[model samples]
Target: MHIEKNILDNVNIWLTPTFDEKTQTEIKEMMTSSPKELEESFYKNLEFGTGGMRGVMGVGTNRINKYTLGKNTQGISDYMKTAFPGEELKVVIAYDCRHNSDTLAKVVADVFSANGIKVYLFSELRPTPELSFALKYLNCHAGIVLTASHNPPEYNGYKVYWQDGGQLVPPQDGEIIQVIEALTYDQINFKANENLIEYIDAKIDEAFVKSTIENASFDTPAEAKDNLNIVYTSLHGTSIKSIPDVLSKAGYSNVNIVPEQAIPDGNFPTVKSPNPEEPEALTMALALAEKLNADIVVGTDPDADRLGVAVRDNDGKMVLLNGNQTMVLMTAFLLEQWKKAGKITGTEFIGSTIVSTPMMLELASAYGIECKVGLTGFKWIAKMIKDFPNQKFIGGGEESFGFMVGDAVRDKDAVGATLLICEIAAQAKANGSSLYKELQNLYVDHGFYKEYLISLTKKGIEGANEIKQMMIDLREKPLKEINGQRVIMVEDYDNSTARNLFTDEIEELKIPKSNVLIYYLEDGTKICARPSGTEPKIKFYFSVNEPLDSIENAKEVENNLDQKIKNIIAEMQLQ
Candidate 1:
């Protein structure tokens, strides 16, 4: 019922004439009628995280609004001018189908154009990966895409990409944040220079689709493509604009779109959430797949940077694959493609997150390539491409439903990934195998690995404190065992140290510092605790594996692994 003094002070500033009349009126209404909402909005400034800023859309300091994004653009404009002095600084802008994304993108473009930076804006909504491709294609200094990437309907976001077409990382992200922090909202230049802004049309789209098809297709026979019955859905997001085009151009003619979820609507009327990671979001797509007796079903998030896939199991029933399962399938398929082409000469590598199944390392070893594991987020995987300049980046993905094929687009690209998965499916079908069968083969060759994710969301100030305390407790009073499995090692990414519980040996982690902790069990199970950098949630990742002697017992083995995870969760009292 009571608001803090600092929150009240922040709110009162928004009521002044310095802000627009509508914003002022909204602030006043929140203060008088809904103090809790006002507190939530003005308690703190929305942070520009390493990837970018994302929050609910509202008239507050912690919201994604014109002034917040305008200030970010202005800061980036200033930073780019300094970073690339005396050069013709250019930036590409794109937006998703989120509400006000178009207007907000225009406002950002106006800020950049007003600052004398040349701007190339997408004439319409496009996939987030295309924006990354266009940034490098245009040889621009930076890129911005306005998308919440499958968050709730009330949310929006801004993600900044560098010249390498990867999201901002390390020193650059920190430097930009410092500059933006030094300025106020009024300092943003909203004036537009029409001459400096150029709207790009279908030319870039054609180039992007061509590049995706070229990079993803492995020359599957035309008969195989025709035999692969595919059902696709955009989940009421931006993929509707380009997915079908890419699939068609790639010579796949049997693609069926989920009609109820095909339109690009910000309201996302057809699903509970636009995120493909959630199974409920794919209900309509799954139904359509069953009706058509489709061999595979593919769905993309709002921005199309991530995808969720479904394939028929050995029993001939449609089953949705988790992010880790999809990652494993895609990574293994790409590695095999490279090997078959004699491209695996030992300098090639793939990228994955630490929280992902360690099966990636097994796959990498079998192919005689390296698996570079980084912290969570595709940005770090993108960093891998930039970090290892000489070694080839075949493909990479995280436990989250994201995959990036090759280095064409330095972000997770569902557009290209969809085509790549189809190639795998089509080729397998032609060879008397299904996608699920290929996955089973992978598990048999390289030990069967099962992964599960649990996210605990705590909202508002009290929730933030609770999450912080939870991490502290985990550090101070560490778990020695889970479900009677002895803890063999503990990896504290926050402290950048890995301790061997048995011998008490500590070694420094050679990666960037993140607030993540992982425990390795003697039974080859890995448990990780990490707080979401972009959301108000703490995620626990569990990976358990077993040696599969034969594919015949794969089902029974998988069931035991599933029960093991459930027992571990119950033992940890996380339920």
Candidate 2:
């Protein structure tokens, strides 16, 4: 294998004394024995995208190691000083169960504290959402969480949050990247300011639990809660720290935790992946639900920002709901609650992503509120809350199993969302219906909608180029028809414009520029193609819907919609 000069230069820099001895040895060993791996490790500097960075843990510039994280923290510290001049700077730090997350977190804290920033470090592993909450609660300038939510065991990540408890977005993210890019690894200050670091545990945890319970609980009767047998799993992540307590304090007593997955372990030994979005990840929880005859089964991803839920269908069989289904159910419930409280004063809005189901628009229309759609990540959804001060953000969710109940956290919160889902399930049950039945009713009232996601993973440099080319091809030669449905309008988010195919009229998109494209068919189907900002994959989202005349035919309508999605996939050759 031939290595580029720049890559070799990067590798040689790591072999120098500026880096630690162990990292140097690993570099030399890779050079002699594994040139391909060595080339892959240093092909390019790991990108710090809009929301921090995540990659496999290794001894290279392109990996998540002590040095990479140290460089990032040092740069962020420098930028913070300029962004907030002369104000006493403070930040909160939290880590997940990933290997070396604690040590890496300490490294980050060391850099921040060295720069005279006060640091509140979690004494134990905590969920990513709590980090968001803790930052705002402590009145800090910024926050950092060391977690790779739902990624493989070999991966780790660092996500940067602003003072508003949301991930970095737009001009701030771009500016920070510029500052970080101008520096070398040797510029990192690893010296610790011992007095500037404080370990926090009980007080913040108590406050976060209280806030979660208060925001998510909506006066469900105690009998309804007791009758709803619930099975919960953390999937070897950090949700166990807060969810159980939140549920207990919210007056839900009958909860069973999956014994095999209850303990926090980064290895995620119980399942193929710790992602609750995958059915396999919830296998153990599903089994426990069956054994307990539970009414609902809930599981959160490793960092607990996203949750996957399973509810009893009309046939008395447990069925797992996808991210979109969960989001629709949750968002609609929140809107109804707000309406009941007479809080919907026409200034409230719900948030979702462009790639999410358009059914969200239907729900928003039904409730007489605006459903503001942004790019693919929850950071954009969080930005919606910050961008609109006067408009009340009732709640929002993405198609990726993440939901934020209110503005308290400013990020996707599984703890609060879990409590909210349980409330919905319990109330539905008390009203002579189940969660699944309520879904069917929703479909009948609105329209039967089905969504499916196709994600293709390509690894290494070659894979990166391949994914880029795939997007380019999609843009250069746009699809005119999908499954014989005429393409009425095309939304190219990269250019921030939508073109009406029938009229050839171009209109500006108010959302920010992103590498995403959506096609609207004449028959009301929506297809969106977007490359993953955090992972080595490209995702295609298909949403197909039809009018359901009655609840009796909901299942058949859903099956037809599912088939429509499959047909579109086959037509696009995405299989």
Candidate 3:
């Protein structure tokens, strides 16, 4: 058995009297029996990314354990004190259905309470959005949610939120990271001050559900609501309670739950990965929908922040719609309802990520509302809402199956999005159409946009280095053309600059600096390359669009766009 000096040093620290007996025993066993696992577990400390610190659950600094969470919580507590001196410090905490989520959440609460900060922890498992909502609804100084968000069962995470109900942004995220880095393991205060801890459940749930119902608008007849059969699966996550309750409250009685997935299980036994974006995750739901002859099938990820939808196509077959299509449908539905209700004031706007379909921007323009593009995360969209305090945030979504219907919660809310999507289906049925048909109508009016995503997963430290090198290669050697289409412009988000390749003009990008590069083609085609900040993966997003003259032309136009994406992928040697 061999070990690097740095790894051995870190391991020796864990074996000291400061660590728990269980953890020390595990480290000693790993050292004597599993040297490889020991090396991987203690090689490095998990750093905070755009979301937060997430890693495999184990007894190591590189893993998500009590010591790491306690250190981060203490840092947050210190920062809260510095940011709000002479004021009562309060924070909300929630967890999802993951292994050790509940236990980890209690540790977070203990650390916060030990620092004299008030903790409003959920009595049971809850979705990520509710934690964000509780942060603002309770007027807390900060909040934390224990979730890995659609990751494998072995992973867990800690997401920090601010008073604005959004994830920490800009200087705050950096400052908090500095505070955590400066602290040692022994410096963490893990003592629990039971007096400062309060269990919050029904009150916050009631408020969140009420707000969700208030945000829903349905112009369809009563029969439409009864006729729209919706099959919802929470992927064994937290939405099992709130999503159904909200739908029932909104007059949706034809909803069916996948009995297998309804029960909250930390292991997510029913699906290979609890992510609805994966087709396999929705397999059970789709089967149940077919058996019941349902109209729509919806699934939410483990934390209930992202949504995935399957709609009955024109051919009477159940087909899954990608994230962009779902976003387009929901965006169109909300805009139409607003116009009908006369709520489309000029002071309203929408938001999406730059990698998302550009049709969102076009749709907002048609409704006389501005659409803002941020970086890849929902936190940026929330930041947009915070930036435009005077403007009403109608709704926003991303290429990932995450959408926020209203401004009540600052994160991508699957609960509210599910309700609104069901409403869209019911209203479409009342208008002598289906959600699939309404999507076609949107294309007829707003042009047909198609989007595709290619994610190359690279694991471990070597994989992380490979992803970094991929980004560097793409940035240093810009693409001049793709599949015969001339590259018109290149936007380097890291440098905050956009270069017009044809005109040789450079302009400043007003968005925050990120490690992303986008290439614009002459025919309105776009290609984006971005590395995942939280995981060891690099993703490439492709979007292309063309005019749809009528419903009959949809299939042909869609096929053409699909082929175009395939051609671009082949030409770029992405496969």
TM-score of each: 0.99, 0.99, 0.98
lDDT of 2 by residue, 433-545 (tens): 98898888889889888999999999988899999999999888988887988999999989999999999999999988889999999999988898888889999998888
Candidate 1, 188: how far from true, in Å?
Answer: 0.7
lDDT scores of the candidates, listed in order: 0.93, 0.92, 0.91
Q: What is candidate 1's lDDT per residue for 423-525, written digit by digit as tens?
A: 9999999999999999999999999999999999999889999999999998999999888889999999999999998999999999999999999999999
Model 2 residue 530 CA deviation (Å) reads 0.8
Q: Superposing all C-alpha atoms, what RMSD in Å does each candidate have to the true structure?
A: 0.9, 0.9, 1.3
Q: Which residue pairs in candidate 1 collide?
A: none
Ranking by lDDT: 1, 2, 3
Residue-pair clashes per candidate: 0, 0, 0
lDDT winner = 1
Residues 1-575 of candidate 3 have per-residue lDDT tens digits of: 67899999999999998899999999999988999899889999998776788889998989999998998998899888999999999999999999999999999999999999999999999999989988999999899999999999999999998889999898899998899989888988999999999999999999999998888656556788999999999999999969999998888999999998998888999889998878999999999989999999999999999999999999889999889999999888888888988998889988999999999989998999999899999999999888889999989999889999888899999999998899888988788788899889999998999999998999986888898898898888888988899999999999999999999999999999999999999999999999887777899999999999999989999999999999999998989
**How many clashing residue pairs are found in candidate 2?**
0
Error of 2 at 27 (Å): 0.3
Clashes of 1: 0
**Clash pairs for candidate 2:** none
